[model samples]
Target chain A: MRRSRKKQVIPGFGISMGVTLTLLSLIVLIPMASLVINASSMGFSTFWETVTDKRVLAGYYVSLLCALTAAVVNAVFGVILAWVLVRYDFPFKRFLDGLIELPFALPTAVAGIALTNLYSDKGMLGHFLGQLGIKVAYTRIGIIIAMVFIGIPFVVRTIQPVLEDMDSQYEEAADVLGAGRARIFFRIIFPEIRPALLTGFGLALARALGEYGSVVFIAGNMPFKTEIAPLLIMGKLEQFDYHGANAIALVMLAFAFLILFAINSLQIYYNKFTKQ
Target chain B: MKRKNLITLGIVTTLLAGLLTGCAGKAAEDADGKAAKAIEITNVSYDPTRELYEAYNVEFAKYWKEKTDQEVTVTQSHGGSGKQARSVIEGNEADVVTLALGYDITAIEEAGLIEAGWQSEFGNNSAPYTSTIVFLVRKGNPKQLTDWDDLVAGGVGIITPNPKTSGGARWNYLAAWAYADKAFGHDQDQILEFMKKLYQNVLVLDSGARGATTTFVENGQGDVLLAWENEAYLSMKEYPGEYEIVTPGISILAEPPVAIVDSVVDDRGTREVATAYLEYLYSDVGQRIAGENYYRPSNKTIAEEFKDVFNLELELATIDDELFGGWDKAQAAHFDDGGTFDRIYDGETQE
Candidate 1:
């Protein structure tokens, strides 16, 4: 007897694969390949020099650092936002939940300008902070704020569905069995949301890594100081130095892959741990 | 299922409630009725010039208002010049296009804004007003950046916008190329090599002139910020005690030209007023406002009057179609985002 086939969502395999391949080539492969081919014309030393340039290196550091910080901050708060929205009843609760996705919908430039205005030394809240000798608008701190502004939505969106689906019956049972709120949260709620948190973290990191518009204004784009990788690539392009831009882009692309890989492995480990 | 519907409704309501609300103020210009009495003119310019241009606009309105007794709205759309040009090319109704550089206008021409001989119609192959590219260094020259060579020096962090996509950035790139050719003597390889070093030193390449300035002055990232002379001057004027303008030893003269859209005005019977508006930009009052913004006035009398504020910049680096080739050639060979310059960064040119 023949084993049952893995029936799927769509029609026969060839048509689906044809569309998938066409999409992949058009959107990803062709453009990426052209970039690589163009970059290959540059001699290896030039490529090395471009990537190792002090300012480019600084940009790489800033891009990595800000993205990580934003991802971490988002993971924590995102979980709470999702948890509250799912498990609570309050006036205008829906409104507050909807606001979490604002960063996703708003133009990055508008967001950048708004954040810069609100946090600059002479900005609205910045005046108070400035009096306390706190510089927010034009620093690494400002970069993190911009990144978090964009990143929080990624995490919150990822976790909200999971929280919504969770059985509150299990939570109530745990409570009736005399378990404390904190313990019940840690043992029951945390494990269930772990998969989502991991997914959110990965998404947040990826989003932050590629972000340019929102952070550019707030980052102040200083070299060996606040310069970010995307900005470095931009600098390369402006000077009419295509290879330099590509070299920087290649490095960023590699770093992104490595980070995503690590994120995937972590996801795997979390899944295994949850299963156990 | 009813409970599920209720939950869906609740989710939708909450999503709406939770949005971070904001609004953008846009000038949806009423182009027709406003032009009935006074002439309506629009220019595609970069952001920093908005204030100066607006001053000219007010004066222009008054000049024409006195003549025609009409309500002329001299509206201006300001962004990076590249974007402005692209918008014009993509069919934004700009009657008179005054961009940060000629190349952007040329790009629009390629998109069929005007035929080949359009520049000569306004001013003989150049702009009515000319600005230069300069280095906006930190106060007191913290990184010791003085010239094009200094930008390539190890410690220098040069800030500029993307040349391939920004009109002002093309001037900055051309200035560097001009400097390199002058210093190293016009060997194609030497100029290319010098530019490669400079690119390596750039820490932040913002998308536009204002963005680059914000990167420099606000973020304090790059040691040297390549800026429009007028923009640098205006920005310093706006922010007292934040930065200093350091004109490079030799820099490219940026000619921001203006040409009335002959067809647009002729079709609408706005020729007299539109022509008057374009002419007004080169008049004494208009030139004074332009000078106030640090753009060198084309009108001779205006220049002489503002002599004290304006420096006689000598030993200037210049580019033309024959020497540097046009923007398309330069972009294809070196500046195009996907061309030679990108390849250099991609490690195709090293060693």
Candidate 2:
């Protein structure tokens, strides 16, 4: 009984898609493809050696572990911040909300430099923390702080809308049914927002993985200590070792892809589980 | 047609992305057609020393104003010394380059930016002013690190950038090598051992010279910092009472160089001005400024004027054009990112 006319939302979808595909292919896809292409310029043995090199390996571990930690922490604190914003009303609430975006607007280099100034032993925070025998700047801990500063907003913004749109009546209904606060939150609320949380985690993790500016100032860049993958890439380029630089970049790109793919799979599975 | 278009789009994007990301400065070829004939010379030099080097540019610009009627605008671009050189080679439009090391200039030459025998074009490899490898110690020498051996004496964290990536760090690395070569008899293995121990003492390797300085001066992580004499002097001057430059009994002589990128200058027709700029650096007027900047003049009296605070006698390293077999081989072998430093860390840290 239904006549199916063309259901295209826009008549120019194909043309736009073509343009988009072309633009993305140039800006994102091709340069990324070159990471692998340039790396392939070297022999397999040389590639293996470069990949397995101690400094490069250290960079890998540092990047992944720090990114993972940052994302996980962002998920926790981001949810907390979102929950606070959504669940409560206080004076300067708009100001508080605006402040959460400081990291997003602040240049990572400036952030790194500022964080270094703040947490250095001679810095104000550093002076106090140093009295207690804790060092932040120029340590892996400094890297974590830098990552956290950059990663927090991704999770906060992602979860904030979900929290705001969340059905408050469900909690009120659960209260009416004699369920406690914790039980209502876990059984009723968390399941509804799991997808958004995963989306935030993926974005945060990816952002942290490729972070160079903030990490560089605080990292202290010691080989096999704090030197990161981006820094290693820079080192290669500085020496005019273009092939070497590209090889290491390819490794980073591969790892970034792997992490993103894994996160996407998890997000998909979570959606399926929740649906069922 | 669709597939072919996709492929073409991909290639165009790749080139565009490279251009965007790399962002080569072509010195904006003199298309101004202004009232006064203007010559734009792109000066690619290393930074943190930018403030001091800009003074040189101002002086040179003044000389041109007095000597000729051409409007010369010298654009000074700076970063890590070695990185500046690489940028020039990759097409940054440097009519003249004054980098922090010969290896970087050598990189420019290997890329055919200049003639094959570019080193012979200037005296002492075009090194304008010399500095010695020294330690940027904490105020009052808390850990009492006197020399390279003291750097490995445990619980003493040293901070320096990667030598492979930084010209100043190369001087720091070569200084350590020179020390090991003298004390333990310069075996490659011994050189490796010393560098390994030195690394073990390092808290972190920063990305650039300024980063390393921050690691020591601001961050307060490292007890001892290997820094350029000029950088160390500037740090002491800037931070005042926060840090001091300690020269070891014998230290590596660090020479920072300048050169004309022959290909670029010849094309731009700025060769006369470029030649005048570099040659001016050797004159008494230039040498005095160089000495004031803590870059030890090749002239001995200029070295002594800054000598009241300079306690460490120079036991200079054996780095020359022949020793490193020019910058090409060095770039291919030791100083390149994945070369010895990367390989060493690769081998050492994998365990």
The sequence of per-residue lDDT tens digits that candidate 1 reaches over residues A31-101 is 88877887889989988877886556767888999899989999999998888888799999989988998
lDDT of 1 by residue, B2-36 (tens): 34335545554455445423111122245454555
TM-score of chain A of each: 0.92, 0.94
TM-score of each model, paired residue for residue: 0.67, 0.89
List runs of model 2 lying over 4 Å from the truth: A1-9, A127-134, B1-30, B187-192, B300-313, B321-351
Best by DockQ: 2
Segments in model 1 whose C-alpha atoms lie over 4 Å from true places? A1-76, A84-107, A113-147, A157-169, A175-187, A190-212, A218-276, B1-35, B124-126, B337-340, B348-351
Candidate 1 reaches a DockQ of: 0.11
- Taking every candidate in turn, the Cα RMSD to the unseen true structure, in Å, is 10.0, 4.3
**DockQ score of each predicted structure, in the order shown:** 0.11, 0.46
